[model samples]
Target: MTDNPAPAVVEPIPKWHEFMVPVLRVLSDGKPRTRRDSLTATLDEAGMTEEQRAVMLSSGQPKAENRIGWAMSDLTRAIAVAKPERGSFVITDLGKDLLQKNPYAITQEILRNIPAYRDYEPQRQNVSKADPVDIAVEDSELDPTEQIERGIQLLRADLATDLLKRLQERHPDFFEEAVVKLLLTMGYGGAENRGRRIGGSGDGGVDGVIDQDALGLDQIYIQAKRYAPDITVGREAFQSFVGALAGRGATRGVFITTSRFSAGAIEYAKSIPTRIILINGKQLTELMIRHGVGVQIAKTYTVAEIDEDFFE
Candidate 1:
């Protein structure tokens, strides 16, 4: 009889509440502690497993360590812990006073009751426990620079997805125009409108042509297929496209498709001597967003900070 396979290793995932008291204890000394030194010793003292200590979050930090950081943050908001010198911190009177009570538990309820933390309690309470990203995002807003950049990134990401969906719904001609506009905005075609749509029945897979310069002689061919999500352009399609390019004596081409290119098609393009840049639906939308092809700016915000050089 064959031996049974060993069971899968189950990594320890501790809830945030489990780390609260341990983090509080690490700062109970009332003396200032450097960021790195305290976190290193705190988790081990709390009896965290080696694997748990080593477990990384999506951001590549140890999960237990991340929770501990959040624990400190919550405590800091309540004035239980005070950050004195950049990453160094000390336990405040409020923190030591709390420890005098229920030294074992420093619950979220207790933290919010304090005046300093109460002001920000509503935003924290609004975050759903079901979504881990919610609180993390809320916490990331603590830094001025990170908050603004994070908001922009979230907006751009949503726009890219929405753009792709809208493109798939629009007319084929619209998609073609979008591809051309994106290239134009990227400075491929100059002020003379070097890109022209030539896609038709006898076009032999070539959809458009872009003049790298104002001159009409040198050309970069474009083959855009507004395919359904389920359709994947394969090697045979690439062979036909490359053949069409060769027929026109063109060595450079862009193959833009609403659907994906098959692995074989991508590999073939990589192996070929000719220059063929592939743009699938995802990348096409991303490029459009970057080049401002079809989207308009909705709102803009300007965040300002003190200019330290002005003080000098």
Candidate 2:
């Protein structure tokens, strides 16, 4: 008998824009409802599973409620929903017409076509006159917060690629020194930052060492290899490093490389008595960014919201 395949995992929640039509439909009866009541009704109309509804955002709000809130914000900007009284909302005639026209899905592009929405949208200064369609396409897909997060992720990815390329171009000694600095920045060298690169002709397989305390009783050895991105560090190299660690009577070591490790190398490291930590090119660059070793902050953005308690 053939074994049954595992069921595919369903997405826990829909995108903010996906909640637009449901929000409108919930208020289509033209009866005024509190924001909380409208959002609860919208969630019911969305037909989300209990597991899906249990998802929460980092801000402690339910994921479904946050997306529904954004959907309502967009619908309000488009003048499709009206606030007839404080904290209560009712669908406008425009919303009814939209529900009739877009029976299946209502998207940001559809909302953008409304003149009222365009008027309400914040105007940008010095927007490129060339390729206007690109701007529209960028705005139509994701809501504001999602767009910001996506943009930041793409920027970091590009920055990581450039950092790896530059590191590969420098001298092998530079790369060795960089790994030592990274370890110090990560707080591995204690508060005094006792770490040094010792890669030379007389040096053993280890390239760097970090003292975890002032007395240097507790120490961690490091082996850094500056290889091309396509090169893979193999088991033989790790065996040599492990032998060197044994010679130094050390139980912990870190092996960092600009390339990747062979599967055998990884397995061998895990099987050994000594603790071995491996850092590849991707991980190295990410650590550099996170600990602000080689990269510096270029810009900072601050987002603020109305203080509800202040009004009270």
Best by TM-score: 2
Candidate 1: lDDT over CA atoms? Answer: 0.74
Using all chains and alpha carbons, the TM-scores for the candidates as numbered come to 0.54, 0.55
Pairs clashing in candidate 1?
Answer: none
lDDT score for residue 132 of model 2: 29
On the 0 to 100 scale, the lDDT of residue 214 in model 1 is 66
Q: Superposing all C-alpha atoms, what RMSD in Å does each candidate have to the true structure?
A: 22.2, 22.6
Worst 10 residues of 1 by lDDT: 117-126
Cα lDDT tens digits for candidate 2, 251-283: 999999987899999999989999999998878
lDDT of 1 by residue, 1-312 (tens): 999999667567666756667766877777788878778767866888786787787768888887777667667656677666567878888788887886787676666557545433333234563342443446556577766665465456545544555676778777777787778788877777788877777877788888977666878898888876557999999999999999988999999987789999999999999999998876787788777788988877776889999998
The 0-to-1 C-alpha lDDT of every candidate, in the order given, reads 0.74, 0.83
Candidate 2 global CA lDDT score: 0.83
